[model samples]
Target: MSRGHRLALAILLLTAATAPVGTAPVTANAGDGALVTAVPNPTADGDAGEYAVVRVPTASTANWTLDDGERVVAVPTDRPAARVALTATPNATRRLTDVPVVAVPALALSNAGERLRLRRNGAAAAALTYRDAPEGDRLVRTDDGTAWRPLGYQPRDVHRYGPATVTGFVLPDSPSLPVETLRSARRRLLLAGYTLTSSRVVDALIAAHRRGVAVRVLVDAEPVGGRTARGAAALDRLAAAGVDVRALGGPRARFDYHHPKYAVVDDRALVLTENWKPAGVGGRSSRGWGVVVDSAPVAADLAALFRADAGWRDALPWRRFRRGKTFAPGASAEGSYPSRFEPTETTAAGVRVLTAPGNAESALVGVIDGADDRVDVIQPTVGRRDGPLLRATIRAAERGVRVRILVSGAWYVAEENAALVEWLNGLAERRDLPLTARVAEPAGRYEKIHAKGVVADGVVVVGSLNWNENAVSENREVALAVRSDALAAYFRETFVADWQGRGRVGRTTWVVVAGALAALVLAVVVARKTIRFA
Candidate 1:
């Protein structure tokens, strides 16, 4: 009777759909000008866990100050958005609503110079344009210099993805660029109703500010602060360089907002990846690819969720986000990658194939309910309690879904979630279920295989969050779902190599976990054989 785990599913659904769980609401940094507001969550630093709306405000007449006492003024207010550059205070644990701690997401959006025009019903709904947009609420017009465009959107009711399903996404880029990803996320948001933001993003704003890229970031109204908010620093830097920085308003949350990691670059490319901070490109992050899709419906959906220039005057800011005539669409070169992503209109309902942090929970049900053939899961950690997610996996296997899981191999750490590893295996044997499990041994450098993805027939989910329930409900997490095989195969191959204990050697790519010890032994054996032969 592997039914829908009705009680568990219902409880999970109810919990996710439930509004905030009685946390105090505080507005710390309330300011004027064009502001992007995001419901700030508890700082991941394990401090006093406070939540507020980040009121980052930027305008021509604005002067900015950050938590680190960093100040920037008279900066150029034209170009891409930038984070205020501020130094983190030493061991500062008290959460500050107006502490002016901006954020920097993990991976900034990718820009390929190529642009696209997104239209609905013949009239242009949004355009994939980029350029020097000022730090105020405005639009960047087309080359013809005719009409204006508005980049900001109003805030709406926010919902978590689902129980254990992070009803959220990640927006990790600079203010203006990050704004683009927020805009892109709007659609999924409108349809699904969730919140999203990122870390590496705040860094982008800082970089943009330093480079004289006119910057302004609008975060959720809630002002949540962490130890080091690179976004705030970027905002400070941009203000110092004469760029106006601003923030808006949001509802205060009792708990922290942890799941957000997506980026939109110059409103050109929308990037979905898991590399945050050291986890992104040019860092020690695991093997991950950033997919930059061309779509405006995506951007518009995100923009709709933000409280658009609501705090500032309705003046044209620059050449891109300004409310104006649509730019000509770019060439529609076929995407070499695979995508079965159906347009919103064509997608079917009741498949209940929702995507989000909560997906971790849904993955089990997603497979149990729909996986008629197989279910393959890969997570660095799978804890006990037979979480709704794990239970779903076991149930699917029991029902003949060929539930197979590949847990990451902690080549170095002794208790590297090995307990959970043994537990997953036990789950299979205890139930005598036809489930298969494997440990992906490390292939190289002190790098423990950290790819968290799952494959259920045609559905694929990928991101940085672990499979553990803690990640589902606690940590800041983000993941993307793809119904394409091409993408799945790529992920599968990488997983296989790690499990086979074969590091595809390249330059000093990454350090192998204690597997390095194995290399040492191999070298010794070869040396001994040569001496004996000689």
Candidate 2:
């Protein structure tokens, strides 16, 4: 028999076996066990695509009815103590969830606010009420069934790790740290990132795969500016070498972007604010911060995160995803810089792994709010002026904690960054607060600021969380909060160097300055000759 027919036969047998024999149906009053557990808003054509979940305390729900104030429909399940979905469209609803679905042709849920109740033989067993529903979101009851809230796309929880040794490094200074760490993997390696085009890293992964290391990679299916030919080629190379590579994204993707940068190598975890591109991990352009933690718990937590992200429905194998897809040609970063800071080994008293679309914003804001001495923020850019993070920083400054924000000086954001800095400085001067902001002057150190980092007191935050609402609320970003004075000092030193523009003049900076001066001299000579002729 076909699958559908088999399912029907199974349901019929279950119903016949579980149905109550010849007794009268029991009527339930208030405080009974049946409850409306969840309701999903209509995201498709009409109300038929929506569903309401009911949980019962007994095996059979033959006597239960769902009343939505406007109309009543009988609960259609003989399964006991199970969570079942009552929908007008069973086949479509089954595709969204694993719960048993029963088609109730008379069932219809409104998008606007409504009150629903579970009735047993005409008596109300439990009741649930909700306001207007959010598009594509589900309203679910609490475990105790006392409260209800909208369910978002949060899949991972905020994880914490106890004291352990961490090796911290800054990019363009210790580019070999990540590659060497990857090469040291013995049993397994799980790498996740927004993009991967670094040849050095790819070679290390291939070598690890060849030596029987179970190497797997997960990256964004569609990175900013789309996938590049070099990135696609790198992924193909890894797949050819028996490495498992998958990309995360699709119409039903849980995150706006899978943009975390980290790798799990056996019992060690490497987290960074950089992508897997030449400008980031290869240490050629962008200045970024990273850490390699030597703790089994940390590595295990990161490994779990990788599996959860990669095992989702949206994750597609590299070969399958590349079919009929086109890639754009992109240039690789070739800039080199002097090593101003070396990797440092330190011990954090505690470490917390923060991820986006759930706990990252509040956790990061807590970091700023807990600042007692100073808060130094380094980012490509921040969110709006009145955003939560900025507001928290301002509050910290008000409480006498010095706050300094350094933003990117890249041309694309230079104008707005300058404006924000001026506004912040103006507010500081007017209010007599210890708040300041500045645009980074790459000043020959590296290219522009690409680090999303903060050094507050003795704690340092390093990872790929951009200080914006969308990044914190929608994207799949990861960051680490390491409470170690040594690590904080290392990142603080680099932040100070970039903030003060104290690095030696890079060749490009010198050439630009020289060209401008030469142009000024020519203008002066022309003006003098014109005056003499007149």
**Top lDDT prediction, candidate number:** 2
* Runs of candidate 1 exceeding 4 Å displacement: 1-251, 266-275, 305-360, 409-416, 473-478, 502-534
Q: Number of the top candidate by TM-score?
A: 2
Kindly report which residue stretches of model 2 are placed more than 4 angstroms away from their true locations once superposed: 1-50, 60-62, 76-81, 88-92, 100-106, 110-115, 125-136, 140-152, 502-534
lDDT tens string, model 2, 1-534?
Answer: 221222222210001111243222222432354444445464466744578887765555447788777899987446653678888898878766667888888887766666677776676665655555554556432222222222334345678889999999999888999999999999999999999999999999999999999999999998878999999999999999889999988655667788999999999999999999889999999989999999999999889888888886678999999999889899999999988898999889999999886678788899999999999999998878998889999999999999988898898887777778778877887799998787888878899889999999999999899987668866789999999998888889888888888422333234556899789779989888543321
Clashes of each: 126, 1
Candidate 1 total steric clashes: 126
Q: What is the RMSD of candidate 1?
A: 21.3
Q: Write the per-residue lDDT of candidate 1 for residues 353-459, one digit (tens) a residue.
A: 22232234555455446777767776655665467777788778888878767665555422545555556566666677777566555443224444566667665
Instruction: Please give the lDDT score for candidate 1.
Output: 0.37
